[model samples]
Target: MENTSTRSTSRPSATRVFVARLVGTGVFDPLGDAVGKVHDVVVLLAHRGQPRAVGLVIEVAGRRRVFLPLSRVTAINPGQVITTGLVNIRRFEQRAVETLVFSELLDRVVTMRDGSGQVSVRDVAIEKDRNRDWKVTRLFVQRASSGPLGLRRGETFIVRPDDVTGLAGSLGPQSAAALLATMEDLKPADLAGVLADLPLARQVEVAAELEDARLADVVEELSDDEAVALISALDAARAADVLDAMQPDDAADLVAELPTAKADVLLDLMQPDEAEDVRRLLTYDGYTAGGLMTTEPIILPPEATVATFLAQARKAETAPALAAVAFVCRPPLETPAGRFLGMVHLQRALRERPQQPLGSILDKDLDVVLPDDSIGTVTRLLATYNLTALPVQDEAGRLLGAVSVDDVLDHLMPDDWREADDAVTDEMIERSANA
Candidate 1:
């Protein structure tokens, strides 16, 4: 729900309070009997804008941390939190959709933009809305220096949500839709990071703002579970659009993870031609050549000249690996490919003869892979040919698609690759950034 309450431009210096400021404060029951110390702040991740504080984690007798839902709370102040007569003594287990301010965000590393410096989060300020729900508004960051045999703390400064680049920083209550407009320039990986760092509801809101192509790019970089979660958050039509925009093989891989009924619905919503490609890929074992190959390759007729191939290659400059080869076939490209002639490697074209006939320079002794070839077999064939791309064919000799090196590595790399976008070498990021 949108918070329509009047709010300050930022957390007022006079009344700004932090999660750290509340911990250790005595919690009093409605009858005024002291019960325990405020152990932590529990926030609901499903808020409309920024997540709101829903309750306090109190350390009662026996060192048990119990849930005290905000709905049961009576009063909250800096020194102590006074609860209503009702309190659930059951131990609290953090839910997938909840966040513990102290455990998750505080002391985390964040880059502050105004100074272009990275600092550690020292504390965070939370404020109340008209409905009395508490929402996080600002981050307090500080650097630490080593003192003589001791840890010396640096001065902490406030960085409102507005100040952090690509983050939903806010000075006050902001419309989720408004926050999305500011995210246009962010890369999918950057967008994913921002989404991951935001609350669940805000993640869905930001996702809703992205175009299908943009969201597909982001989804490709997310883990399966995370991708499924995000896709599920979207409306059915939008989710289907996003799946359609992704590489067919990748789309099928993800679709296979979804419950069958849901997967079928998405496939049904997709364009018939696109859905057919995914359906074909779904039939291949995930570790086979067909499983990893993308259905959208640059295909050219056998009579097409090298210049024609060059034009197609130029269109794929952003993804150089995709230009590995131009599949050549007879007219009316379709099942059985009308006679699989061969391919023209982008690098094999001599600069002196840009107009050379592509058919005349067909990749000689071509090593084609069958649909069910094992990844190891595909890898060996690719290595033996010194190829950056290899063609996958059906038994009938149709040029199905080409498998780029990146597609192969995507499956072999460590599971955490998508989570470490910033881990790229500066040169790689710089080239991609400028390109």
Candidate 2:
């Protein structure tokens, strides 16, 4: 492969070569003394709103890896990196703001428009931006390396970063707002991760472009801070619409995380029923049953048939998670849920005739809790019985809503779990009726 740039800054030429060629190239001082061999290049993301090379890791002796700051670098080409010989002897530690191209980026699948079509990164091409700062401008994509085909026509084109999209459904930086109009059926948390990876400007653009309902789903997967940041970017009406689209429990959590004035405005903008649901949940302690339980679950009347249960389960497929059990309750479906009949495990509905009523199929040994029940009690109830969901009742034994295990996990896991690299996927959601 050909490459460009030269030892003299004023001298320019057309040269092109893969970045990997620089991996083991020898580094030298201005006097031509050998400083070391190139180990890796360090890039600071969003440096000037684009990833830019900031430093390099060079091996001085057999064991010592020294940092060669970018300011000391004079030239970079296909197989060689020239430095001013000055180096920091300290060992390299990747800062949160920095990433090693050869380590964090290589081989990761990047996509366009969410996860629609993807390209595997063989190498990233760094070029001098208009400011003369080294910025990652293109990717050497391995088009069809995984398939039986060796390499196709479009297999090795070098395209700018914006041309690529998601990494396992993540949104890459510089993705067009139009491409994001279609979010491709992705898990909310996965979509959130992609959103988190985008630059703030593009993220806001996508925010304005996304449907309120879809935005709500993706927002539910983000941290309260990130969710608030994105929501604040939209018009007040759109923000309220997004909050309304989210489940009442998750909506309440996101709202609670916002400023009082912002939350109040959103609540005021929401429909009375939806606003009231979130307000009620907000009043409860986040770690308590009232907080852990969703205001909406599969609630049914005793007279509701098995067919009705199946239909509800099917509708819940569109939701982030489904209630594993259906609570048979009286009218008002609210906190003082009127009279509570027992619950019917959704699994039992499959065994019985669709035409049959649910009353006869209720679990005889039901363990229920009040909204004020401690989180420990709720966790024990869910774990001990291997129950996928537990009913939350009020003082009157009225069924309010069900406490799903996913909610329990949400309350119990680390604060940053939604952004965790191995985020909990929609397996919990997919098993809408799983026990």
Candidate 3:
């Protein structure tokens, strides 16, 4: 059969509008093969704010509800609506539902709160406007307070639609549909944050709707434990792809947190170097500097001049942690020959004399640490010196890695660490079980 999925970019014509209006009142012919009665017209709004009839919700024999998009509509008359193709209700039901209208979401637990206060939403405010258009105008909340009658009137709060903490736009049926359709357009970080607040089932549902790259970003932003949990919920192939897209250190951490058999399966699917880095980090104690540091940073030779360092830095594809500070070290910071000479802040490197030897301009007296240092020691050093990051070195003073303020915060908070622990745990279990 010829495909009837219409892909139109233009607004619905006058005739289309008239037909849409008659949707609930008219009978529908399934291209002369079957018949049904229209129950509703699912309107999809264009970017320009024009409402277009995108689909028809019809009630079939025995009270079965079926939806038919405009593309499937072959004809429409005063008495009857004609569909050009057949639709399997079971298949339609199986397809993920997207863009739920505010009306439909009403009475459902939604995240909202009074202005500047804690988040709390007891009920959604449904207002009938002058035009009789029903809209979710505000969120109602209950608080504690005293009343004028010498009796306490339960404290109640209202949150205007404008004050919504989440994504904005209309919460009408059509708008809800549009939100669902364009959900993938949002950045993963944004989507992840929103999803993070949702229940696990809902998170999985929304995650399945996202593309691989976007899903990867969501996973990357999640706490290490959360990422591992989410990935474990996904199919092995999809989970592996997300891990592969993350930074090597992050990927390793997450992999370590997973169950051994699964982690091994995922590792076997990943590239060798990435799997190795994650495996290495898995060996470290969770509370140590080594556990918090990322291996991907910019390293500079002690002999390199400020000018050269600037040039190299400009060209180097370093992570954000490395980009903030230029570390100057002699030979191997991990070996006896290596020494932590000094460091150059990016701002200083840009403004200072270009011809000056890096050693002369470098902050010779630098705060450094051994890999085995406790989280408490690292946190204290960072707080005392007010440093953005501190270099971690071996006993010989070779730069093994550097930990950022974020890493320290993660160590302290524990909740902020993403994806690394699970990956390590998985690998360890796998190795031990195999042995």
TM-score of each: 0.58, 0.60, 0.51
Q: What lDDT score goes with residue 286 in model 3?
A: 69
Better of 1 and 3 by TM-score: 1
A best-first ranking of the candidates according to their TM-score comes to 2, 1, 3
Worst 10 residues of 3 by lDDT: 1-10
Between prediction 1 and prediction 2, which has the larger TM-score? 2
Q: Give the better candidate number (2 or 3) by TM-score.
A: 2
lDDT of 1 at 377: 85
Q: Pull out the clashing pairs in model 1.
A: 161-169, 161-170, 162-169, 162-170
Deviation in Å, model 3, residue 128 alpha carbon:
6.0
State the local distance difference test value for candidate 2.
0.70
What candidate 3 gets wrong by more than 4 Å, as runs, is: 1-189, 197-217, 303-321, 330-340, 353-357, 414-435
Q: lDDT per model, in order?
A: 0.70, 0.70, 0.57
**lDDT (Cα, tens digit) per residue for candidate 3, span 64-157:** 5567665676666666767766654631231223222222232222233333332223334333345433344444543333433332344445
lDDT of candidate 1 over 338-402, digit per residue (tens): 55788788778645287788889897588668988988888788778888888788777778877
